[model samples]
Target: MKVVVAGSSGLIGTALVAALRRDGHEVTRLVRRPANARDEFRWDPARADLDERALRGADAVVNLCGAGIGRRRWNGSYKQELRDSRIVPTDVLASAAAAAGVRTLVNASGVHYYGGDSGDRIVTETSPAGTGFLAGLCRDWEAAAQPAADAGVRTILLRSAVVLARHGGMLGMLYPLYFLGLGGRLGSGRQYVPWISLDDEVGAILFALTDDALSGPVNMVGPAPVTNAEFTRALGRALHRPTPLMVPAFALRVTVGEFADEGILHGPRAIPTALEDAGYSFRHPTIGAALAATVGRS
Candidate 1:
């Protein structure tokens, strides 16, 4: 199969491209910079422009383009960056995929589709979208891909969790602090932190690409969801360190603004109902196992 991947420079994108290549699939990177490689093509998401030929003969197009949500404190400008980064590239790709007669479009979405807080309720692919900026952002993000579906293409949304890896994503940010024994849970630490191992994250994308039965929102997370406090304890165990230090909610808000609340302190207890029913086995399913594997890799 031939695949075109946007945001091929990210942590997940980098891993996904390598995995796809390793599996004997032809992959082309849709990059923002100059196309210097044989397998790369330049695209301008800002202008909703991509060479239509890039999509021709492609079996699947995986879009992972977006601004880093936690890169800075959320203000009006950064929030607009968050929304525009996702919606623009997705609109461009969806339009291109439809016109190119692409069979599949595996777009990156998020679990924030379930809202900021779910308390005891566990969300699935079928759950109604929740309220708040992130939830609305996720809703619009997924909506931008509707053109592909309208054109009879199989469109799948990988409603991803906080991806965990030693070198990038959430774990990368936390590993150094944990190594120094200064790591702990955020806020009261009781909120669920839905997560996926980096291996599983890339693997799930591949599964979505080929799994013909799957369409619409598919939660790309572990079967078991752990609370922030539980995750803290498990991560501490993985590093053989104490995790007594805790960051209060107010302190985090002061540091990272609103994301401290919605993105960090509160999260959905989302389950990968679709993945499990599809019999997708996770490489690192448990928090303890995932953390230990992460530390070993470092």
Candidate 2:
């Protein structure tokens, strides 16, 4: 199948593109800069300008455009930026997919759709959208794909969890601290941390593209859910270091502001009800195995 991908330079996009190509699918990357490569095309979501010519003949459109949520403090402007960053690109693609007659739209979303404070309640794809800034963000983010859905396109919203990889995502930013033996639980360390390895993340995306039964929201997370303390311990074990520290809630707020409360500390136990029902197996089902796979990689 021919796939048109936005945000091809991102962490998941990079791996997805390679995996798609390895499996003999034709992958075209949507870029913002002037297009020069045969596999690259230019599109600007801010202006809502897309080269529809490049979108033609595509079997599916995968939209992954978004700014880093935790890369900066959530000021009013940055919060608005986060909303715009996702909505604009997704809206653009959804509208374009319908116009281009694309069959599928596997759009990106987050586990925070269940809110940052879901605590220990087991969340599934059928679960209603929760509250808070991220839940609102995710709600609107997935709604942007309504254009294609209304146009009769098969649409799937991937509510992804904390992706674990060696070079990017949360691990890239937090691993250094863990490696230096400064890593431990946050606050009470009881909040759940839903996670998935990069490999499984890519694999799940591929599965969604071909699976006709999948629609609406699918939790792109692993089967095993662990507490913050368990995650901290797993990382320390993976690195062969001792974790004898804890970053308190107040300290996190002082460091990353409200992200500490909702983004960092609160945990939602999202299960892959949709994926599992769809009959897709997880490559890394446990946090310890995920950490080992991620850290063991070259």
Worst 10 residues of 2 by lDDT: 289-298
Please write out the lDDT profile of model 2 over residues 1-298, one tens digit for every residue: 9999999999999999999999999999999898889999998888888877978999999998999999998999999999999999999999989999999999999999999667888989878888899999999999999989999999999899999988998999878888887888899999988899999999999999999999989899989899899998889898888899988888999989978887778978988999999899998989989999998433
- Candidate 1 residue lDDT tens string, 238-263: 88878979899999989888888789
User: What does the lDDT read for residue 193 in candidate 2?
Assistant: 86
Q: How far off is residue 283 in model 1, in Å? A: 1.4
Model 1 / residue 137 / CA error / Å? 0.6
